[model samples]
Target: MPQVYIVYMGAQHASRYPTYELHLNLLTEIPVNCSPSESLVSSYQRSFSGFAAKLSIDEADKLSKREGIISVFRSKTLKLRTTRTWDFLNFSHSVNRNPPLKSDIIIGMLNYGIWPESKSLIRDWDLRQRNPVANIQKSEAVFDSEAPLVTSFSSRGPNLITPDILKPDISAPGIDILAAWSRVASVSNLPNDTRVVNYNIISGTSMACPHVTGAAAYVKSFHQNWSPAAIMSALMTTAKPMYPSAGQDQLSYGAGQLNPAKAVDPGLVYDAGASDYVQMLCDSGYNETMIRIVTGDSSSCSSSTSIGTARDLNHPSMALHVQSGKAFAAKFLRTVTNVGSARRSKYKAEVRADRRLNVVVNPSKLRFLELNEKRRFTVSVSGGPLPGNSTAPATVIWSDGKHLVRSVMVVYTDFSS
Candidate 1:
């Protein structure tokens, strides 16, 4: 059987026809019977500008050269299942045990829905016996332990929307997780299955979102006044590096895996304000009227507003794409705000990069005189010709010896040989 593949054509560049019409035209042009006769696997017009269709290796190759096409790849099947999440993240021991009130915070999860009957979610005694915290035992033996790893199915990225800012600000445990299940539906999602269980094991990026959502709620519980960006900063900065041997980049496992404990007190944060994002949108070539429509304000981009790149956004991690010459050089401007104790808040910059690249930080030493105080710094990277078309990976750590504010830097340069 011809396998299904997703043919991503990027954003619509065809102005003459509608999205569906364009897809129809493209399919018609191809020799494959992609119309109703053969049937398309799926059309991704709403979420993404792509379509899934059954294509032979040769047909897919031929279509790859089609105008506006970005990438053509085989559709992958991802597997699931999880707990040992909290234990793996060291969330059980490092943080307080008492769970926060469910009413105060709501963890929003974009997952395969929930199985209310799972003991990990709601114990039977809690419902029937009216015991609130009866089966709540934070023991290792009860929850099976495994070496923490990034799921193969979990998505990785060199963030498409904003290449400068890394997507998936942080990571969380979401493998072989035992959670509540939906009684009406089958566990494995097979149509013919006829089993209904209270608890089911599942995994995937969908489950990962909820874990971080819960952690964000936990952080919100402690710092109620913090903005969404600040909470995000805390999570990313406090995340624990994962599978060092894996040799992954920021795009691979983003800010490492989630650490709910250290996140609560991330000494410092690179916070982005609402206005800053608005400015970013403006810099992205959005007109004043369009910006107003989105922001819901009469906010206009004026001469006073600096027209900087997306990397200017005060994010925890840095990904700068430099298109330089023979002597390639670029500078990344970033600012960090002290969010921890003012008395002992002092940090120094540490640079780690490939030998071919020369990374330097200005005013490497940063001293915080008060909480909420902001310090600005620039990372200047100057390197010779990249042997071939290659990306140079680097890291800058702002550490006070107590808190390590790590930033992953990827310099994509095309220097003249």
Candidate 2:
């Protein structure tokens, strides 16, 4: 069967060139069950040299092996996360006094499920158990809450398109949000009701995105020169940690709820640049050709420009996906730039782990004497064997009497569970 595949060829620096010919030259020869012209769905060249085409499994695999091709994979649909009422997040109304909420990330795989009898699915009635939950009033369910609760309509996440990186850097209030809407639209989205008014309560990404962007802008207003990653690091490290309910972990809330006030003064930030990301891509087994496609430049990932493994990207959060059920150890090397209010401050590391996990931070104390000074630290995590789809959460905090820079460490057996 032919599936729509997105062939990633990296970035196309030369936008003036026609990408159809380039794509045609690469795919015209590939055997397709349909017409050759029909197989070429769309050519993308303004930003990248690639195309979306309908290809069978074997054809996609063959095209993926070709040089200059970064990746070839089937496309998956994703639902948008709902909005915050950020006050429900306790981010406060004054957070914007001048500007953020992009936090709801659909983590793990919890879909409504497709045709279970399809050959692609697990073809067994044994696994298809009936849900005990009743859906008698979903269309009539009222979402009126003053606190944070994952709604029944909370969106599900998709399969991982890349390794290591986690979805949704954070989470916010995504329920019972009062936001703007069209004046002519119905309030209840029912045909019988014709309430033509402006400003409707929404609980989707439309309002969720603004919460985070405003938070980022608030951080930018304070630190005019901080990079985008720096702002993200500050936000992640300063998020308020929460205890997960059943069937939830760090993946649900990410680096915790957004804290705009705390983020502006995060003592240190895990900084990353284009070069760091490029090095990570290269170390992860991608070649120079794919790197060129991604960077749109002649950036080389030689050994001399090393920063260690993908785990050493200086991300605010640390995660590990283990395949084996046996006891294993994971280590993350990170560098944090001191963005503290005082340069003479000294920060100490504290690790809080679950009973089944053991965590250690090297050089527990980081003392900085100059602004923008960088310090490196290593986190080594060891834990009891975890069953498939199991995850463990731990909290790592760096405190200097005044500021608390937090990072969530999660160890899971699978990203798609």
**Ten contiguous residues with the weakest lDDT in model 1:** 137-146
Tell me each candidate's TM-score: 0.69, 0.62
Residue-wise C-alpha lDDT for candidate 2, range 133-158, written one tens digit per residue: 43433233233443344443444221
Model 1 TM-score, 2 decimals: 0.69
For model 2 the TM-score comes to: 0.62
lDDT value, residue 384 of candidate 1: 81
Off by over 4 Å in 1: 1-83, 93-103, 107-147, 243-247, 289-299, 322-327, 387-390, 413-417
Q: Which regions in candidate 2 have their CA more than 4 angstroms from the true location? A: 1-86, 89-146, 152-159, 182-198, 303-308, 415-417
lDDT of 1 at 21: 59
Report the CA-based lDDT of candidate 1 relative to the real structure.
0.73
**Per-candidate clash tally:** 11, 17
